[model samples]
Target: MANTKEIQNRIKSIKDTQKITNAMYMISSSKLKKARTDLENTEPYFYTLQVALARMLRHVPEMEHLYFDSREGIKEEDRRRGYLVITADKGMAGAYNHNVIKIAEQELAAHPNSELYVVGQVGRHYFAKKGVPIDIHFQYTAQNPSLHRARVIADKMLENYENGDIDEVYIIYTNMKSSVVVEPQMIQLLPMKRTDFAGVPADVFHEEITMEPSPKAVLDRIVPNCVMGYIYGALVESFCSEQNSRMMAMDSATKSAKEMLDDLNIKYNRARQAAITQEITEIAGGARAQRDRS
Candidate 1:
């Protein structure tokens, strides 16, 4: 009976846990949908900006801009690199945060003279707990990514890049192509290189566009938008990936809970049957002993 009671209690506890997990699964699913919608909505705008920038560059091959040049106005002795890592504000998101952080650490290791900027509470807390230095941390961006927040981060980073406080800028984030497809990507954001414009075809420069003012002026304005777009796009993708990860994690948890509940039910039934068998045996033995005494 004691064993039966313990099994019953465990079964009850697991049922309660399953309920919570199911609820969480549903919640994460809803959030994932919204995040994906936001991601999709922002996708075209950024890609268009990137395309336009590429086209502008192709139009004037000799165009010179501060964006393309890595003129970090500081002396070589004071030169440092900047690395920005995007993660999730909350956990229970599978390997979303883990993957990003792991790669970011690699970036930090690769660039010994690097300053770290992190987006997400998880990254901030993890780094702080590990005593890893972080120069900047945006605590709220992961939960709710916005163009405004992206701009704020971009402005600061661009300023640092321009002033030569940091020469190279790398952004590490999870790129969510779909719910099932999320990959950790580390991309250099500063000193726009020709390779960065891989999206534009090689022969795109064959066409000619009339430059109203000048190609240099046009590129100068468009290049900054390119940077801002990259930052915003990463934030959007990371946000979507985080939500999808949470949803998947919760779904897995719910399924595991169901399996556990099934196993617990089996154990509970076995214990219950054993108790009943023992009770029936004692009753039959007592009856036989009475018959013998009679």
Candidate 2:
């Protein structure tokens, strides 16, 4: 029922929106590709280090590294946990930001009185709206996930873990598999898992090695560095996931807007044609009636 002018304006508005979304999609595409390459290159090193540590631990049962230290038997009263929630700094990424914050909410609800460390502005704002207080709000590193920035964040996490402020640390972020697929994940960063190592199945190698500086001393040097490497890898994965999610979201939005504009333009053209035909019929009938009167 809209007039021609009104329909024209609506089409123009949608076209402008489509342009913006298209630009965003292109930008995200470039960033996602770079991030994935970075993640691929760095992840192997972390895996190798973890495998070496696992093999060493198997041979040297006397090793007592804090990272591999077990707190599995601790009482409930002594258990306090920390959460590091990673989200995108900007919006227009569909449910990417929302899903991550929802995951954090579920986690916090399950474990009461947990400390929160937020990486992105989106997560920080989400927690603030839910009346959740953040213990640490890191901005620059979250915006740009590079090796140096990741190292700084990891060192800070290590400091907190060593000081006994938190018993366990968890990182919540999205994992990128490909351009269109991103999976949300919650992984334990501190108190590293015993099973996720490259050298776990190599039993022959574990038995033959002898420690020169002692296994415990080697673990003290290696475990923390390896943990840092893992954190860096996670950061790279998270960065890729964010960009991929945004790119897909924008692509969908642009396509939807184009379809809507096409539909509206069709309707407008039909209405205008109908109006023109009615006017032509009226003019012809008026001329015939005038000739008959003459």
RMSD of each: 2.8, 2.4
Q: RMSD in angstroms, candidate 1?
A: 2.8
* Model 1 / residue 242 / CA error / Å: 1.6
lDDT of each: 0.82, 0.80
Name the TM-score of candidate 1.
0.90
How well does candidate 2 score on lDDT at residue 261?
A: 94
Candidate 2 TM-score to native: 0.90
lDDT of each residue in 118-230, candidate 2, tens digit only: 98888888889888989987776655788787777778888888887877888888887766788888988887756555335653464488766877687767777786786
Model 1 clash tally, residue pairs? 0
Off by over 4 Å in 2: 198-214, 285-294
Local accuracy of candidate 1 as per-residue lDDT tens digits, 1-294: 349778788878888887887887788777778767876788877777777777776666677677788665666555587989998878988999999999978867766688999998899999899888999887688778888898899999989987878887889999987768899998989888865776675434547788668777777677677788888889878887887887788778878878888887888888888989999999999999999999
**Segments of candidate 1 deviating more than 4 angstroms:** 71-79, 198-216
